[model samples]
Target: MSSTKVIYALYNDDDVLMDAVKQTRKAHHHIEEVFTPFPVHGLDKAMGLAPTRLAICAFIYGCIGISVATWMMWNIMINDWPQDIGGKPSFSYLQNMPAFVPVMFEMTVFFAAHLMVITFYMRSRLWPFKKAENPDVRTTDDHFLMEVSVSGDEEAMIAFFKNTGAVEVKVIEKH
Candidate 1:
């Protein structure tokens, strides 16, 4: 694969970075990515990013959890070894559903949370022992980095970033 020239603009404050994002969008610049130490509220809207669909995945995972819990409980209590526990006969799953509410709720929450984390990690291409893809290490601590792809006019882009409160701006050849 070939490398491309990209400009990295480092900002000290998230407020300044947010403003710069707005100005960059206004000036019709295509921002490749932005890295921040913490989540910056409203930055997604400013960057025109689409809303995440992770909630849909969570809902599906929850449904799967509930179904599995119901099936497992039915097999254990009603089919495999039906027995009288706490003076209640394990005759019908529907009749004994109230007793299984806590289990069902816990399973639903457990599946949703665990599966969501796994899904997020997979989607973001994060894995154990993998090297960080961030261009600047400072962005993980106190700095914010904005990457803008440049086809021409590197000097103008650097000047634009400096004008927008960038602490440092440099053109990098991204592999």
Candidate 2:
């Protein structure tokens, strides 16, 4: 496969960046990625990205946590050593489920939150001592960066980006 050339467009304002994204899509230019200092609402829909499935993963993790909590409580309270506390019966788990409700709920929340964080970290390839891959440091502050892959022509793409209100346009050839 041949190497690719990418155009980096820098925008100072989020509103201008949003409009540029819409215009680029309408012009049939493939937008590689967009970097922003903060989340831009409705930006994903404009870029035609698929909806995230992280919430579904969280729900699955929550179910696992509740199941573990129930099993542990049943074994500890009813099966291992039956003890009467607060005049509540310990013979049947169902009879004492009300008391365990707090524990169950806490565990569910804990697992969903912690595991989701870990999953995000892993999926993003984030780890201690990893170097950052941001092309422009200004994007982490107040600027936005839009990367577009150039196919046939370079000057026309640069002109197109300038017309889209890019503050700076740089052409990068990737190895």
lDDT of each: 0.94, 0.94
Query: Model 2, residue 143: what's the lDDT?
Result: 99
lDDT of 1 by residue, 5-99 (tens): 99999999999999999999998889999999999999999999999999999999999999989898999999999999998868999889999
Clashes of 2: 0
Instruction: Show how many residue pairs clash in every candidate, following the order shown.
Output: 0, 0
Record all residue pairs in model 1 with backbone atoms less than 3 Å apart, i.e. clashing.
none
Off by over 4 Å in 1: none
What TM-score does model 2 achieve against the real structure? 0.95
* Model 1 RMSD in angstroms: 0.9
> Candidate 2's error at 110, in angstroms?
0.7
lDDT of 2 by residue, 24-142 (tens): 99988999999999999999998989999999999999999999899999999999999999999999999999999999999999989999999999988999899987889999999
Q: On a 0 to 100 scale, what is the lDDT of residue 140 in model 2?
A: 97
Global fold similarity of model 1 (TM-score): 0.97
Single out the weakest 10-residue window by summed lDDT for candidate 1: 148-157
